[model samples]
Target: MANIVAGIGWHVIGAGMAASFYAPIEKVKKWSWETTWAIAGLFSWILLPIGVSLCLLPSFTGFYASIDPHLLLTIALFGAMWGVGNVSYGLTMRHLGMSLGIGIAIGVTLVVGTLVPPIMDGKASMLFTTRGGLYTMAGVFVALIGVAIVSWAGHKKELQLKGHLEEFNVGLGLLLAVMCGIFSSGMSFALHAALPIQEAAKSVGVNPLYAMLPSYVFIMGGGAVINLAYCFIRLAAVPRLSLREDLRQPGPTLRTNAALAATGGIMWYLQFFFYAWGEANIPASMSYVNWMLHMSIYVLCGGIVGLALGEWAGIRSGLLRLLWVGIIIIIIAANLVGVGMAYSQ
Candidate 1:
């Protein structure tokens, strides 16, 4: 029971990190989005993953050599899929605008990422076989409902603003949003696929707490390659965008930009760092529920952050009330998952 509580605490920290990971990027100056993102991806996906894994899993480099190479490839491929999903998010924003795009995209991501792995493994039936599994599943579905309510609130808020965005294209946006959700779930798939490697880590005297660390090395390495390639392509094709923006003023400006990206990237990676810790605390049977807990807490935290940032400043009282209702629902959903985890244990 204590372990389950610890796991929920760790998951909350990770989800909060996930919620705020993009804040540093918002402060980055005079760089194209592609450039800042690419730089951030470098620290988030490559530098940090390798460095942290080495600290936690000292044999991480050699650990891969002893495992089936195919397992590594599968994990990396899913990482690439997540990369594609990450990039698609920009397009989703372009077509749908931030409030609507994020609402839809994240909603889809929450559902698909939480549920697909069990269904794929043909263990969906197990969710109904136990009280814990049933509670977890209920929480997952309720989280989705909360997401929908929140999205509706966002839609109302956006409509109350000046007007719909000029570029809004619902048809294309919907399709892209769905695609992004499916592919964004790739991160979960990559981690799920690394189950074998996690077991191997445990057998080789790796501490269970750090066993999942090595998995990030391959997952994000693959993401880094795809993300960088896309950034390079974007830099070449866009007349106004350039990697040169990174060096425009050089000296302090360059250092600041680099620092911002590094901060953002490291913050992003920290989400998984705590997530792995959370997973380490749960029994394998109930571990899959952590993703749902992560997503639920992530959405709830994101909403709280939005409120803190004054994104709700001009909103009508009714809409704000509705948003609060949604937030409360998400909080309840996350607790339900935690209770489910404790019960299962």
Candidate 2:
């Protein structure tokens, strides 16, 4: 019970970090979106993982050499598909805005990421037959309701702010959101696929919490390949934005933008960092539940971050109240998941 509670706490902090990561990107000036995102990916998807792997698993290379090449390839391939989802996630936010985009994306993600693995593992029946699994399922349903409420409040807030919503491509945005949700779930699949490598990490005296670091190398490598390709493609297409110029000047604007991007990247990575720790503390049989729990808290905390940033400001009192109520429900949902995990244990 205590371990479950602690794991939940770690997830909360990680979620908070993820929810607020984009705030810094808003502060980045004089850089194209492609530039900042790619730079940030350099840190989050490449450097940080390598750095942490080296520090934690000094024999990281040896561990990787010992693992089956097919397994590594498989995990990295899954990550490549997930990279497309990561890219689509950014597009969804661009087309739909944070509130609607995250809400819809996470709702789909919650369903897919949570249930698909169990179904694939042939344990879908356990959700109904097992007490803890059933409770976890209930928590997922509750969190979905919470996401809907928050999205509703956001819609109202949008109406209040703009008098009418901006003319966005609702169909396209929804498509992107759905795609993001489906593909993002590949991440969980990637992690599960790398169990052998994780076990290898364990054999090398790496802490269970950090055992996943080696797998992240291939996973993140796949993402970096896609992201960097997209960024460079955009950079080439856009005559205005030049990596050469940015490098030559290296002024305060460049420095500041780089710093902000780095911060966002690090913040983004922390979500999974603590996710690993949280999962490490839980029993393997129930680990599938971790994705849903993590994402529920992620969206929940994201709502809180939006609130703190005054995203709900200037809305009518009623709508603001709705937003608050929605946040509370998400909190309750997270608690329910924790309790369910404890019960399952």
Candidate 3:
């Protein structure tokens, strides 16, 4: 019962964190994407994870030090790939709007993130051979269908708003979204590759949850490198991307940037933080479900926010109803994944 409570708490934390991540970006006024992303990156990809890992895990340094260089390199590369996806996501959201962007991104994330690790581990059959596995796969299919419905609703909304297709680029948005899914899913493989560091933490009598922190430090370093470079290039080209200039801007920009940076950082870290803690609650056999469940809740919360903000303002009431239906399907799909995990255990 305690474990179940822990799992539930972690899931809630994960969902809230994921949902709130983009809230900060909305606060940056007049700052270029380069400046805003860089500021947020300072906390999200760099400081927060390192600070938390250091504070919570005494053995973090030693555990990280003990990892094989080759394995470390591989994980770092995977993190870089995930960074590309992260960078692309902003562009996707800009081009596609949050409802459709998230729908497409999370949909691809669900399929690739759920399937790739199992396939890599040579346990692809686990997704089909067992009843639980089959159910989970079915959930994936259902979730994809939900995504399609949501995307279709977005298309309808766009047509209603603009009266034509030229205003929105569905093809480009989807392509970027698919890429985000593939690369974002790579983080799971990166985590698996860093198992040695995790074992080292266990060997030192630390909580396994604490052990995962150091690996995150290394993995996030890769993401940081990519984003940092992108920021620098933008700053260079624009010449006014200076933090000094950004701070000099009138009313709430600096304060908002700092607040957003802190919030986004904490929000970003919370995903892995809860993921690590949640993994401790569930059986190893059911661990993969954690990612699926996390992503599903994120989609649900994002969808709610999208509606609340009237992103679908001009769409017909019928399409709005279809949007809600899609959200329901996503929730059902998430529950199915949970059921599959329960049965697998």
* Separate clash counts for every candidate: 0, 0, 0
Give the clashing residue pairs of candidate 1, or none.
none
Residue pair clashes in candidate 2: none
Model 2 lDDT per residue over 139-200, tens place: 67876786677667655555565634453345667678778878888787898798888888
Supply the global lDDT for candidate 1.
0.76
TM-score of each: 0.83, 0.83, 0.87
Q: What's the lDDT for residue 100 in model 1?
A: 46
Pairs in clash, predicted candidate 3: none
lDDT of 2: 0.74
Q: Write the per-residue lDDT of candidate 1 for residues 296-330, one digit (tens) a residue.
A: 67766766666665666787998988877776676
Which order, best to worst by lDDT? 1, 3, 2
CA lDDT of 202 in candidate 1? 83
Candidate 2, run of 10 with poorest lDDT: 161-170
